[model samples]
Target: MEYRKLTESEIVELQNQGCVASNWDSISVHRQFNTAYIRHVNFSGDIKLGIYEKEFTLPGGIKKHSGIKNVTLHNCEIGNNTFISDVNNYIANYKIGDNVFIHNLELMYVDHESSFGNGIEVTVLNETGGREVIIHDKLSASFAYIMSFYRHRPALIHKMQEIVKLYTQQNTSNIGTVGNNVKIINTGTIKNVRIRDYATIESTCHLENGTINSNEYDPVHIGYNVMAKDFIISSGSHVEDGTMLTRCFIGQACQLGHTYSASDSLFFSNCQGENGEACAIFAGPYTVTHHKSTLLISGMYSFMNAGSGSNQSNHMYKLGPIHQGVMERGGKTASDSYILWPAKIGAFSLVMGRHYRNSDTSKMPFSYLIEHDDETVLVPGVNLRSVGTIRDAQKFPKRDKRKDPHKMDQINFNLLSPYTVQKMFQGIEVLNELLSTCGEASVHYTYRGCRIKGSSLRSGLKYYDIAITKFLGNSIISRLSNCPCTSDEEIREYLKPDSSAGLDKWRDLAGLLAPSTEIDKLIEDIESGRLTCIEDINAVFEKLHKDYYSLEWTWAWDKIQEYFNLSPDTITAKDIITIVEKWKEAVVKLDWMIYEDARKEFSLPTHTSFGMDGNKKDQKIDFEQVRGIFEKNAFVEAVLEHIKVKSKLGEDTIERLSKCL
Candidate 1:
């Protein structure tokens, strides 16, 4: 990319083409620069022009040579084969890369030294100022989670902030980069933004101070009427359709469109948000909200689906929208559902209707929070049998759209992991305490600002037992799958914990689910100044995520001894067979419940409103045509298949155990 002096003939040819410059001596051109086609272009300050010899094909099959027309460049370097034309204002203080296209843009400029959205503190979660995460190009959801929420560890927070500041300083430049093969067509204003290779930014309104982390493999798109400021949109993401964002970090393959307005939020991979307003929220992987009336504010969420008209109140009359809530992974809200802030809903739980009570159900995962006559009723562990829960778990891995090999976020998409299983273990103790304190015959028990009925308590205990057995059995079976033996010594060795770390509490730090001990180690490293780089922090999360299964087995081994009352050292084949049978029963019973729930969709009551113009028989016929019979439903059929597969798997494992015995 060496530049040579412009020839006298070339200068004369440029003068003939109406191209003017402040100082002709200060401008340099490529060796093969052709000034014949340049027209009405004004160049100022230091400028370098490359040869425009490449031809481009328009959408309508018209071929045109790459050349500038009716544009103004201010202290810019134009690369070879790049076309810059019809800029209404001026392209100032920028380095346009090779083969880049900038057409019909109102203004594109870099004003002084800029980080291009890096090191901009995003006031997430609390939204006041204590939890300000400095947004960087490599800032994943997990890292942001720690930086925003783990403020109690001030040293770790300071270290993380310093690391981000170092990254920002390293990335600071006066001249912004428009990477090779980029297209900025029909855009309005792009100020201090770094456009990456293969990015298609068409019809964008205004993009200021952001880094579009696009590459050739997975090109990012910022489409019509999109206004983003102080943002870092990662690769494979699409922020289009009039979406407005400020101080946000949008992760890989995420979609934010249809007039979605988000501020001070972190949306991670595969999240689809539309027609909603999100403020100071942490939206993790697969957290989706598609309704305009849905307002998710001052909350932490992951693998969640906010239903239509779902709203959460962050402020009581005393506080000024300062309080926040956490809906753990796989949680869902029914339409028009509401929750007061400072509440914590459990993982895989469902919230229905409006409740003013601030409930904490974090210890009771897979539960339901239903509002009955203005009272919040908790039905614990009922969602373990839900078809939707299983479907959501199965679909997440299949829906991953990130094609980049270097995935920044290490997402563990397991539905039942050490995280939830630990909660279940705690839930069993809590339930037993409740039953002990308030006798078994008590009609209802009150705990954590929610009422649990007698029937619900009994059912919850049963559901938790089934889930715990299933998890422990699944872990043990997986461990012994490849190493089958008849001896109790071999079984004990196989069931022994791989690592002592997983025995402690587990946490879902956004997308990275790991034992709290591992998180503590990361914090300790940061505090000791051993982990300073963002890459180093991300590497730790990746390591923990990769070793999830091994850690999970460790946790399961401890639970098997505690809950099943069987010492691993002397456990026989009969015990393994019994566990496998329990697992099979839990698996099939849950699937059958889901199957029966699916049948409710095609019941007579469901057909009452259908075929309103005809009789009840016509209603049934109409329902059959439109909704189809429940037996023929796709999800129902899948549920049946799941039941059969799990049942056969359990029988096969038990049969193998019987042979060993």
Candidate 2:
């Protein structure tokens, strides 16, 4: 976009059209610029203007000519075919991109050298600022997870912080940018903000020191009284409806609206917050809170759903608001639930009622923490067979709205992964120990500040066994799905792991599930100064995500060796057949349990409140109208189909192995 000095005749014409410039010599215009399109505009400092050659077709098929009108600009470059109209307070020190439309804006400017919200320390997880993650455009939840939680590794933290500082220095500039094809209308007081391509800012109240990382494929939208400061909003996200954010990083495809307020929080991909409040929290992928009364404070959560009035206390009487909590992936809170800080809830667990006890259930996944008579009663391994649990797992992948090819958060939606399965294994051992020490007839046993009833303990063991069997079976079946070998040597060779990276403990890094060894290797690289760029760290996480399945096979094979007591060197076809039989039983049994649980929704007890002032027949009809019959439900039918498929799979495998016998 080359510019030439304004002609003497054009300057006279601009003056006749009520346009004035502080210094005529400092003004430059595009070669094809016409004086007819510049009207009643005041320019100060150095100004470069482009030709207004096109018209913008706005909503409702209204076409508006592209030109500068009734605007005051300072040290600005207006790109080709862009329109700036009715800027009340002036736009200063900005590069306006091509095809942009800015109308009726109160002010948009960069007052000083600014990084546009990069390298801003968001004090998340703890309000008193012990765990502060520097927010940046390239920051992933997994990356932030390490920075905020892995503080024990000072070298790694220092290296990461240095990298972010470098990024900030590289991006620091005196001029902000409004990218191509963007629309900013009826906005108020935008300062030191970098708006990216195709972003839509409509009726926004205020935006200060932020970076909107928008793109053509996944454009961000800020609408209706949004007040954001010190933020980085990623692609495909929408912040609207009187939402207020300070020191926050809104990740890709997230939605924050309906007067939601968040301070010092980090929201990862696919998170949604409506009519709620968040303070100093780490909201990982799929963390949702829709109700107005719910408040998430000083906690770390992922794949979580907070019901209405769900709240947590971050401060005890003796200290400041410094306490924090961790709710592992797939955790949920029932309506009006409350949890005290410094508590750790397990994965796939549900919390109900008010509980002040600082309970820890990190090793017990798929459980329920219920407040009963001022005591926290933990029912472990119950969510494994829950209909809602399976539904949520199925919906997350389907509901992912991120259209960007480069997704920052590497999310794993698996309900039964090595991370959770390992916990289940530990949960079974803990339950067994409880039974041994307290005696089977004791009826109620205590663990981790919660009471576990006798029936729940036995059920927990059964549930863990079923899930473990199902996971191991899935791995073996996938390995042998296309196996052409029939001999024992070929079978052992087929069973051998392709990679040994996942043989030990696994971790759920916010939402990404991978082996701890892989994560440690990444941290080691960072500590050793091998990975200095944030992109390099993200690339490592992506590589680990891509190689998840092959790595999972290594861990599964190790578990197989431990459980079956057969090494890969001596494993036989008969042993595999036995394992398949047990897998068949496990799969069918769990599916049956889930199916029965789904049936409970249609039971008479569940319909007690339905069909008011009507008979039993009306109650049945009313329940069926809203909840539908259990047999015809989509999830129930899928479960039934899964049972059939697994039964046939087991039969086929057993038949194939019988030929070796």
Candidate 3:
């Protein structure tokens, strides 16, 4: 594209068409520029324009030529076939892309050199500044996970920071970009922001120092009075309806709307926020808050849901909002629930009522933390039988909205992986120690700022045993599902783990669950100058995710040997058969427990409100119409079917092993 001054006849044609310029020599155009398309435009200071020969169709089917009209541009290069109209202030220092439509915007410019939103230090998790994550355009949830939690490994942190700093330096620029096929309509001041291809901005109030990493495959939408500063919104996300954010990072496929206000926070893939407020929090994958009164402050959460009016206190009046808390994945809070800071809640646990005491229940997964008469009561292993927990596990994978091939977060949606099972094992040991020391006749036992009743403690032990049995059995069965083994030696060979990488402690890094030992090895490589880039770190995470099941068997094999007190060298066909029998019993028994739990919803007491104005027969009819009979319920039928399928699977495996004897 070449630009040149207009001829004498072309200058008269431009003057007749209401085009004015400070100096005609300063205003240049394409060699084939059409004078017919130039109308009602004011240009100043080194402006260059591309040839526009096409027409743009408006949303309501009105068509207009693709040219600059009713606009004033300064120090800009307009692309071919772009339409810019009604810019009240001006668009300066911008390189507008081809096929773009910019209309009714107040001002769009770049003030000086900027990195968009990269390298902005967001003080997350701990507001006082011990945990600060520098956000970048390519910042994945797993990368941020290691930076925020791996504070003990200072070398690893410094290495990651250096890699990110290199990325920021490469992206620093003077002129902003509005990529091809972008639409900006009814927008207000956009300053030092970088817009990517195929992104849509409609009715936005203001955006400053941000990067919208949108593309044709996964376009981002910013709409309707939304205001953001120093933020990075990733692909396939929607931030709309008066939502205000400052110093935040919104990851892929996320949704934030309904005037939700957040500051110094990081929200990862598939998270949702509406009508709530967040400050200095790390919201990992699938975190959702839908109510206006919910305030999540200074906490780490993943696979979490906050009910209406759910709140947390991060300051104790002595410290200046320095207190922090951790709620492990799959945690939920009831309406109006509150938790004081410095508390650690376990995975898949539910919190109900207000708990002022700083309780730590990380060793007791699948439990309930309830408030009874101003005291925090812990009921361990109750959520294992909850229908809601099962539903959550089933729906998480289905709700994933990321359509891009390169997903930002590697989420693991397993309900009974080694991450939670390890906690359950510790919980069983703790409960047994309490029962032995306090005597079985004691009414209540206290541990870690909460009280557990004798009956509840006994039941918790039973639940933990059932879950552990199910997990180990699932692992072994899956490993040998299609093995061609007819002898005891062949069966033992099939049970041998493929690798030893997962034989130790495991961790859930936001959503990607893997062995902690492997993560440490990767960190060591980084500090040793072996793995030096962000891509290298993410590739290691991808590899760990790819080999999850192979590694899972190694850990499960070791646990099986320890739990049953039998080694592979001496174990026979009879021992394998016995484990299969135990597994069948555990699976069927747990399914029966869940079935009975669901039946409580249809109990006789639950029909009290349904029969307020009816006789006995009418009451039965009304209840059947609304709630339906428990035997015919969908969830009940699924539970019964699951029991049958699992029982048959276990029995068939045992029968096959009998031949080896």
lDDT of 2 by residue, 62-163 (tens): 999999999999999999999999999999999999999999999999998999999999999888887999999899999999999999998888999999
The residue pairs found clashing in candidate 2 are: none
Candidate 2, 405: how far from true, in Å? 1.0
Return the TM-score for each candidate structure.
0.97, 0.98, 0.95
* lDDT at residue 387 of model 2 (Cα atoms): 89
Ranking by lDDT: 2, 3, 1
Judged by lDDT relative to the true structure, which candidate is superior, 1 or 3?
3
The 0-to-1 C-alpha lDDT of every candidate, in the order given, reads: 0.89, 0.94, 0.91
Q: Sort the predicted structures by TM-score, highest score first.
A: 2, 1, 3
Model 2 clash tally, residue pairs: 0
**Given candidate 3, what's the lDDT at residue 76?**
86
How do the residues 22-67 of candidate 1 rate in per-residue lDDT, one tens digit apiece? 9888888887777865788998989998888898787999876787
As for candidate 1, its clashing pairs are: none
For model 1, the superposed segments whose C-alpha errors exceed 4 Å read none
